[model samples]
Target: MSDDVVAPVATAAPATHEPPARDITDGGPDMVQFLDADGQPVALNEVNSPYAEYVDAIDDEQLRSLYRDLVLVRRVDAEGHALQRQGELGLWPSLLGQEAAQVGAGRAMRPQDYAFPGYREHGVAWCKGVDPINLLGMFRGVNHGGWDSNENNFHLYTIVIGNQMLHASGYAMGVQKDGMVGTGDPERDTAVMAFTGDGGTAQGDYNESLVFASVAHSPVVFFVQNNHWAISEPNDRQFTIPPYQRARGFGIPGVRVDGNDVLASLAVTQGALDRARSGGGPTLIEAFTYRMGAHTTSDDPTKYRIAAEVDIWKKKDPIDRLRKHLESKGLADQEWLEALDAEADELALRIRTACQQMPNPPHSEMFEKVYAEPHPLVEREREEFLAYQASFEEED
Candidate 1:
């Protein structure tokens, strides 16, 4: 291991009923953190020096922009949660606390880069130029997915756990075959990013994708947002070793970053992506963060986790940290902050209005996209379904 990378220390597992008490604030010595929990800058150190140049390249305007992204993304999450509560959506997965992780990684990609995201990557979608309303349409049950994946190079949200990793691996291999990797031409070189949560690491698909990506030398990065829970299950239930450490077994370089620190997230991800574009194969980035909300509208996080744990993580809120940094650095003032908050409110109103105005597609519309060309079997089923509906209408 390089001096920058620290090896994992194994600890005895606690009893089944009583899980080990984790210090939520600490991301361990190996985790790269450019900003401390209080939003103060951490001076360049061994673990973070490799990625400092990336952060240094960001200008004052860009720093403020990142802070804006963080604020708006959190607002988006609040709206999504509210919409679900009002029965506007069938189901909604809240990205309440993972905004920095998603936004940082999203902004690191070039125009040609592709992203395969798990369902809750709203922040990534936003950074990739995907409209917030488009995301809401899916949960509202009005459309399969609201946007064309090809339009923005952001794939439709994948609902199945870890499935998108395989898709991303295959896509990366395809990009390699197309001579997109290691091309000195910046416009031609491409890298793929696959996003998943902590629970996804336990899936066979995730492991298999890594194997293919390693042997094929595919240009891809696996970003695991270790939000500390896979639904109700904690990290202890997922793996004995952290995801980044396990990347070594697959012959890939692994790094852990403080997910709440946007600068660290952006810098580290940019480095990994640069490595991938230059034909360095894949890297696994485990972003140490927390899910401050329920797993979904259907979940009750309070049932499984204690309020104290949530309170501890709240002190490290990603948005609050970035705002503090901006204020301390004189990059923003009260008036500027208020204006951004107003913009967020406007965005929330727009999202709410767009969602309520979405037209529900006719049930028969499902059959339209089942095949590119007309098929007798589908036609038969469509007719049968319509006839069944007609019989109910007649009775009424």
Candidate 2:
């Protein structure tokens, strides 16, 4: 081939190089940590540590309640997964881990504050005082959502990734317009929280929400539960910069916390939400955590990741860590722990029974809410559906 004929330019096959190694120290500068993997208490720095005061505020009773919440939430999640496997639920998104992240954030919010959750926020729901059976109803196909969002100030679970950020931001703006921010009255002042996974940060809505919140100084906290995987894709594919750092680009302050450490999660979330309620503007919190189970009941983690990695994270089990800490401090004993286990078993039984007893909605129920006023097409369809059902009945 002549030089003028330049052989068809060979393009190197897309680089199959593995992701770059992440630097620990610099990669996570804002990581607010209160406990180590071994459940040992770590000293707090008043100047640099964002969560020191929050962690210091916890008493023995609250510690025990946190443990109980963790246990019960785990049990609820486990039962939901089992019910799905047994064909009782259409699907289940197990919060097998990350209990600490959800519970801590959930517990920190004031009753007046509002929460917008991703689908896998069972622990948060538990903290909001939603009945466990109500959660199972949605999975069982009996209701669109189990609880009333207004009643609990907890919005329905949002399956669409990152959409809740927009909703929460809008709600926060509404709260501001209504003069609910910086009232110095905890009972009247309100802030909004939006929950999302690490992958959610990649969505346009997330950025748009941040822009609006930052510009308006809306009373909202954007909480990203960085479970390391957005479904099968790892965090590296979504973005190289740490999620918390990304907030700086949007002009919102951010902090990263050891999500597995419940106390840290609680403290960080509380701090962010408090800032929002105080008219300080939106804040972003990246709770660095892991997903121990499949993304959902339909997923198989073994296919994409190795067992050794899971084993490593297992050692950092949130529940186990907290339990050890409590035991070591003489805050709880074997007897109390065993009693909690018995309560968990009873809760599991109740969940199983309630899930099985849920009534399936009638076929016509779908048409009932299609329109505020009766539409000709919907009426015709409803009639046709009922006729079809009648055809299945025996002739008398």
Per-residue CA lDDT of candidate 1, range 1-396, in tens? Answer: 343434344222232424347665587777899998888999988899999999999999999999999999889989999999999988889998899999999999999999999999999999999999999999998887889999999999999999999999999999999999998888999999999999999999999999999999899999999998899888778888888888888999989999999999999999999999999899999998889999999999877877776787889999889888888889899899999999999999999999999988988888887878999999999999999989998999
Query: Each prediction's Cα lDDT score?
Result: 0.90, 0.84
Q: What tens digits encode model 2's per-residue C-alpha lDDT throughout 53-119?
A: 7888999999999999999999999999999999999899988779999999999999889999989
Worst 10 residues of 2 by lDDT: 5-14
Candidate 2 wrong stretches, greater than 4 Å: 1-29, 46-48, 372-374, 394-396
Residue pairs with colliding backbones in model 2 are none
**Winning model by TM-score:** 1
Q: Each candidate: how many clashes?
A: 0, 0
**CA lDDT, candidate 2, residue 371:** 75
